[model samples]
Target: MSMNVSEFVWKRLQEWGLHRVYGYPGDGVGGLDVALEKAQGSDGSGMEYVQVRHEEMAAFMASAHAKFAGGVGLCYATSGPGAIHLLNGLYDAKMDNQPVVAIVGQQARTALGAHYQQEVDLVSLFKDVASDYVAIGTVPSQVRHMVDRAVRIAQNKRSVTCIILPNDLQLMAYEDPPLVHGTTHTGVGFPAESKLPEQEGLQAAANVLNEGKKIAILVGAGCLHATDEVIAVADKLGAGIAKALLGKAAVPDDLPYVTGGLGLLGTKPSWDLMQDCDTLLMVGTSFPYSEFLPKPGTARGVQIDIKGDKLSLRYPTEVNLLGDSAVTLKALLPLLEQKTDTSWRNTIKSNVEDWWKVLEERAMHSAEPINPQRVFWELSPRLPENCIVTADSGSVANWYGRDLKFRRGMMGSLSGSLASLGAATPYAVAAKMAYPERVVIGTIGDGAMQMNGMNVMITISKYWKQWSNPHLIIMVLNNRDLNQVTWEERVQLGEGKTESTQSIPDFPYAKYAELIGLKGIFCNDPDKVGAAWDEALGADRPVILEFYTDPNVPPLPPHITLKDAKNFMTMIPDEPELGSVLKNSAKELLSTVLPGR
Candidate 1:
């Protein structure tokens, strides 16, 4: 049977078990649209082509799907502009080490060498981002091999891979005998086959750790499944655990020694512990901010990681253990000696306890306009046990980093590596799709919501029912300004107040959701925040819940430096309009007077 290349590609995708793919339609991908239509007509036997408004979002949705579902994510886009649009989202996967495959449609093969319209050197453009594998499938015979190679590299290596298919080749008759399909089983297998350093290396690392009095453990996303082993190591050494933002759930926050994230988004205990520790045991994290860690030569260091190249990338190390976090910790436990001194552990716990009180005072403050901290404070406990929360990078991320608490089984991220905006909606939609029975929540500021929220909400309405009992709730902190940028002006740029240029108009996003047949609620009264959650939870369809929060409320750093303090006091008073903005919403910071204990 002579099968067209497009149909052949789609058939192999089915064989590989990729059920749903995201993309936008255009002429360069006309062959794909035809195959997709045929698949849709065949009554659910082939892949579901999820239609998205923008190719950027299609890629983001795909990346998030991989993150939440634990497999290679799939997305497609057409020719130049559409191909370019996938870069940002693909980078998110690249930086986080998530496996994602992007398929780009090129102009016809005959037009490739010429400066044809909408044709780009996709191989060159995608080289850096999809460094694992980037290739062009030039002829019909290469389609299956190209697709299979991309899928394998993306999954086995946990990186991004791209394949460029010219429009002409997509329509050509596939004459090669079909390779045996559906016999492959490269399922997601992890807690990865135990990898441990040699016995001598493990002993040398233990010797360095054992020599120091004040030890601290900094863990990253690589420690996701080694909670007990990590806790055992911490308990054995009487060390405190400080998590990287990506590894927030590596171990539960309820443990006395598990100080939360490190860096700008870190907790007070985490900052203090890193500052005072004489020894640091780094595990599985590639946290880039060296300033937040113990100053290089000040502490004895030992690193345990699966990647040897990443062993001491962030800090100078005395010993490097090239192994998986779980396996290495388990192996090292017997070699570790139990600490007899409880004073250091007690001091750390006391500081953490007091920090909670400080956080509570800030969250419970009675301000003129609602405090943004209160929103997260309320949302924290209200989240269902099986919920997954995604916070965009901004002031809201600070609130999430400081205030939002993840129950043991819950999972989340704060756009840690890319630190991009407008990812909350795409992340939440993918989370809801991957885990239909769990509640998915997105907490974003007005700026991020306006950028990519509305379209993905529409995407949710399209494929929502495909999952079993899917529930998606987006909480928009609409303060009528780029709240994070406004605060950055106050401190980072040494400016007194916000300017109109950093502002956004308050759109009735709730009304927009309602108009589109989804539930919408625009809330201003702070007292009703809980009630909005109730109403949203009651609705079967997706819901948009917007809260008008105080734009003046800043995300104060956990550990303020002399430079940050100086920046706060150094105010820019030159702008004439600054005074009026203060007069109008100066009340935005009523709680600013409260002691940030």
Candidate 2:
């Protein structure tokens, strides 16, 4: 069998160390599909192709794969709509700074300008999202460099890149670029280099950190691999550590000085730490909310990041150390004076203890059916050792941020900057694919579950048996309302919940799981939330754990500003679930001070 353009493309990707691809099939990619079939063979002995129900899900899975597996994620799609479907997930990768390469099928070269069937200008469509690099293959010779550059750029820049393959060109006879002036040649592989800040810059940062009596450390996804370094520096400075949502797993929640997540979906301890700190050490995190940080001139700042452009972006830093998170922290650690006065650290630990108790009270508070927080609160202690978890956007993210305790060895991520709904399911699927030995779990709101999570369950159903440990669980908060947006309208826009927009039709999520050959468990009882998780964790196959939750229970912010309070109060008169909303809010708020209740 002679090599074709499609064959060479896959071969090159394999050489570059990408062994898996998440994608959906279409006629536009018929040649590639044929080539993939030949490559995988009857024994399934080649590139792993995850056939996602939708192209969008494929891109999301690719993004998750990159995050969990620490490699360049790859996804494929057909022409027009399929190519367009990849944008949302690709944008998710771009915003979150994950490396993902998308190989999209395009209309034939002759039909491209003619606007023939399924004809779309893919290059222009992908230009913005894949701003670093996007190219279309016009001939078989161009395919080589296109693959090499796309993978290399995506990996090195930690951004999305695209290679558009026209249908006609995909089936063409493969050929190396001729040794002529007009032709180009390319090779595979991105070599690793030790990235470190200069000693002078490290010393400057240490000086700022050393001068302050109270210090706060904020870590994001960039610090995932630098957990030890982060802990060491925080201990040295006697600082309290706060995590950005994307950095939930960067440091274990068990540490007394680790104040959980920051921002709207953060902890009160974290809020208080930032408000009081005299110094801020930001490591590999471009956590967007500047308000959650120390007020300007209140704290001296030192930021360390690999990307020079991202340095001092969120806060004004006295020293912007440009280097890898682990490398920079290691160098800076030696110059830092170990704090002998443990007063600041003790205060932070006390605050963290009080915050956790408050969370427990809130989670245990009574609701119409179940408090969504309780579901996660129960799962926190029950989370399987070394399990990988993913959460979707909406009210669920609030519980995901506050209630769950991430221990070391456990991995968790979601749509961070993008904050898109319908990402949890695909992320869990990809995590399972990458580490089949470990258990994976996904927490999704009903809104997100209906939008994309339910569909990705079918993908899970198709591949569950192949995994070594069949313990993937999808937990759906069946609130029958777009709860997050409803609360946002009340708190942010000062409007009542619009039934027309907020109410989503209730679906039998657990039943749907059973219908698809997976285990299903529904729990509306608060007492049974933990038991349901146990059942799901011990299931013989993938399971859908549905919790019939109360949507009226507000996902309160860590620190509600006076304006936010006023805005929320303004919506009370017209709010449809006025009684329940007011009651839940009161109970949640009182949980903080009402000791031993």
TM-score of every candidate relative to the true structure:
0.92, 0.99
Which pairs of residues collide in candidate 2? none
What would the per-residue lDDT of candidate 2 be over residues 1-597, giving only the tens digit for each residue? Answer: 579999988888988999899999888898899898877757876788989999999999999999999999999999999999999999999999999999999888888789699898888999999999999999888889999999999998999999999988999999998999998888777968558978888888888999999999999999999999999999999999999999999999999999999999999999999999999999989899999999999999999888888998989998998889998898888899999999999999999998999999999999979999999999999988999999999989999999999999999999999999899999999999999999999999999999988889998999999999999999999999999999999999888899999999999999999999999999999999888999999999999999999998889998888999999989988898899999999998888768348
Pull out the clashing pairs in model 1.
none
* lDDT, candidate 1, 520-573, per-residue tens: 988787787778888887788888888887776557766666776676667645
Scanning candidate 2 in windows of ten residues, the lowest lDDT window is 588-597
Runs of candidate 1 exceeding 4 Å displacement: 37-46, 175-194, 572-597
* Best model per lDDT: 2
Error of 2 at 61 (Å): 0.3
> Could you give the C-alpha RMSD of every candidate to the true structure, in order shown?
3.8, 1.0
